[model samples]
Target: MRSPDQRLTSEAKVTAQSMLLDPSNASTNPVENWRACFPEIIGRSPAMIAALETAAKVARSDSSVLIMGESGSGKELFASAIHRLSHRSPQPYIPLNCAAIPENLLESELFGHERGAFTGADKRRIGKFEAASKGTLFLDEIGDMPLALQSKLLRVLQDKKFAPLGGNDLKEADVRVIAATHMNLEAAVQRKSFREDLFYRLNVLPVFVPSLRERSEDIPQMLEHFTEITNSNHSAPSVSFFTDAAIRMLCKYSWPGNVRQLQNLVERMVVLKGGGAISIDDIPSDIIRSIEGQKEQAIVSTGADFQPNFQQASSAMPLAIGGRKQIAIPDQFGVLPEAGIDLTSFIEGLENGLILQALERTNNNRNQAAKLLGLNRTTLVERIKKRRLAVLNEPSKEL
Candidate 1:
């Protein structure tokens, strides 16, 4: 019998071949062929799968799409996928970062400029809108777009037409607009920094990409994917495997920089280790310290009889998720009753408080809260249900 790894690889190859045979499978249900077509976008988490499905559905329409996610969470990848899967795939897919470009040049960059429009305008320049006509224009970091530019953008979206700088003729825009931002546009709108009209115009179809911590279960796969990429790009030797302890430590890390951070770490590891097996020592010291801190906190919070046998536990439980080993203890305790204390009620209340705090830190985003508490979404929900705590602004209880 083939080993599990070999079997998995064989199955993946078969699936890829089948997808190639039926090209229509991608258009009809792109999510089904997500791994085959979008290898750069990696995640098997329910949160990610849902976001991709929504993107695929919206890709069929020409309506605007607003992608919300933390920095380095691959918003551009989703935007590109939408453009590629859309009817305008034959046309250009232009991307311009509103934050990267200067405010003065941004207007001309989006609306073009005629000769002698400004000091640097030596000749007629085609802006993003004109260049992306009949295609897609991805406005990344749209929240950082100047208020003046937002008005012009709103006009273009509204009328499907725009005039170049220092030009009288109005050019028709047949392009779809896909805006992405790491900022909270709603908050920006409330603060009068981002235009309200522009926010509504871009938010026709919103797709929220969950942060890396929200989908830590996919870390192993992502590490492998990045490893392969690093090897192929640098022509390094193939990485055999990552030690289970190393994988667990990585999975438990709070990736503040999201997917991009993980990719960078993987590249560094491949180069440093020369594509050999990655052991726990090979991981960065900060990551190791973070994992250790979390483990220590978990033990202290539970108040359970904890032993420092992590290495033995890791070796024994090679597949333990998040590097945590659960030890069950009998519910026996010495009771001192001057005034009777309800231990059950106190413990329950403490648990509820922690859950609420986690929810608050994550802005009531359950997936993120679950990660914060080191529990899966289902377990988190069950805890919430048991405690009967009211959570406001709970974004779509699904996953």
Candidate 2:
């Protein structure tokens, strides 16, 4: 017979194996057919995997779900996945953006309106709730919904019935609610901007989508996905693969706009570069500057070599400014050399370089150029005047 400790150890090992083998653990048991399961969502980070697992579990039920994440973090995709995984997949999955519609017409949009309900109501129309009676109703930017509408929404949730605008009889609805928002509903409730009761109702099954910055490891996969999309959409100019250095720079970027920004960048590059391999030169100057800034901060923090890694990684890389080779300021023992760097001059040079690049990219369209440089048109004009950049001071043209 085995000793008590040995038997307990064997039992623990069996339990561990069982947990590892569980299909719900996305990290260990990868979903063999993710395309069919989560067609729009893509990522392999621990946070993303955990979120997908939670979404899958919650999809089995008809409970209301509130998805929270940064803007462009793919909350709608999660909402759609939940609907697809649920029993109501065959039914219509209607989506409505609460913030996009005007406050005056939001009620009519949600519950629909009858003929002669209002001055502009020439004919009767069904609302999202009625349209998605047996399916799902995805409410994007739910926190931006007006306080007055929150009460009506709460009533519908409580009774599972609603009346169309200016209607007398109550209509039944069997729709599942999946709301998404980048705003903090709890804070909104505390501020009285959002109803506390309504917040509780919508947040029954909260699923937080991780931002792209949080899952930097997924950048390469996302790049590939976007590239494929770009290629499929256009002919003649096929998508090009990013160089290793370029990929590293992209992975290091803090994507404030999340996946949407990355997708835009990919499409822009694919359109501009035709079919060659994407190098550091293909990247936007703003993005390159941001990456270099991050590297500078890291070097300062670690008191390491001040020389940027990119310089060594791609010696032939063209500088953003007039194709001049980037100046290397050597440091000794974590200290500035006797010939200390001119900080103001360096900043001005960087700014001038970015402005010139933006002007060239936009074909001398001042407004568009200013937007690319994240400056007001007037400010850009003023800078051009200050720097005596006569080339940029030509007649302005709107794009």
Candidate 3:
């Protein structure tokens, strides 16, 4: 049965995302297949495997663990693996997304209350702490937890006990703590946004998950796994895979959003293309833009990549603009200070800097530089444009 929240999003953009909740409903992907591809609990990367080994070592010990990583990076999986490998595997494993709970209700949710403790308490209940007694309680996205609750959580971790929202008595739980976050606690500490003592308590046994870009070598395997799972969900008789060309394009693109973005892309492609292959044409315009931008970046990287103040200019640039509005380019935006001085020399120097960068980008090849600069080779020669840029000081060569 669909929940009320699920029904509310029935016409939203993520209808298909919900459909993917039960891939086995369509086809049973051999657990071994996924395990073989992704292989490790978190991943097959060396750092991740080392993390697993460390987690296994600590699994038997009755100590709190903190799994840290960026969003979409698998932190809960590590928590579950820890619980499964532990002696308390027979008990329940409770996973809570702390950010999902409302601030007012968090106290009630974490610690059970008497039948008449609060207004919503129509009957007695077992809180997450009691429910996960003798097991693990995985707290996901703990960074967003309110400061007031942090004290209580710290108390729970320290004494393994907590009082219900409205009760005067205290309850004890044997649940092991496993907290996860995408936030930088050290920075939060400096900013006084996070409780220093709570941060220290949860800082034990920290496991940091590497970003996808750091281990891009694993992307191919991840994509293959996601594609197959998607195909299975679609009731496809055979496995779906990206074509070599499509895979090439995917490899070329920089995944800023990491694995989650890749998963979303694969799901979108499967729904829209309805085949075992994802073609370049099937890729969305933004994805194509990312790939093309990477290619252009490679060319620009040879010389004009930075051009000084590029990042500052980029920060100043708007995310969206009117189709007809020609927003100022980096050159126009990097003008001199507000001082009423001869801005001509500064502008000319900036132009020269850009020109030099363009020349170096083409490796002192005059014709290529001219084309890159949107000028004819003859025009460049007539102007005696400097072809010897610092990035490449070789003599100019014709196209």
User: In candidate 1, what are the lDDT values of residues 294-313, reduced to their tens digit?
Assistant: 55652223221222111111
Worst 10 residues of 1 by lDDT: 307-316
Clashing residue pairs for model 2: none
lDDT of 2 by residue, 43-72 (tens): 988778777877876777899999887678
Across 237-323, the per-residue lDDT of candidate 3 in tens digits comes to 555678878777777655645577788889878867777567777778876875565555322212122212211112122111112
- How does each model score on TM-score? 0.69, 0.67, 0.63
Q: Highest lDDT, which number?
A: 2
> Candidate 3: which stretches are off by over 4 Å?
1-42, 236-239, 298-399
In the order shown, what is each candidate's alpha-carbon RMSD?
14.3, 18.5, 16.5
Winner on lDDT (1 vs 2): 2
Cα shift from native, residue 215, model 1 (Å) = 0.8
Candidate 1 wrongly placed segments (more than 4 Å): 1-39, 237-240, 298-399
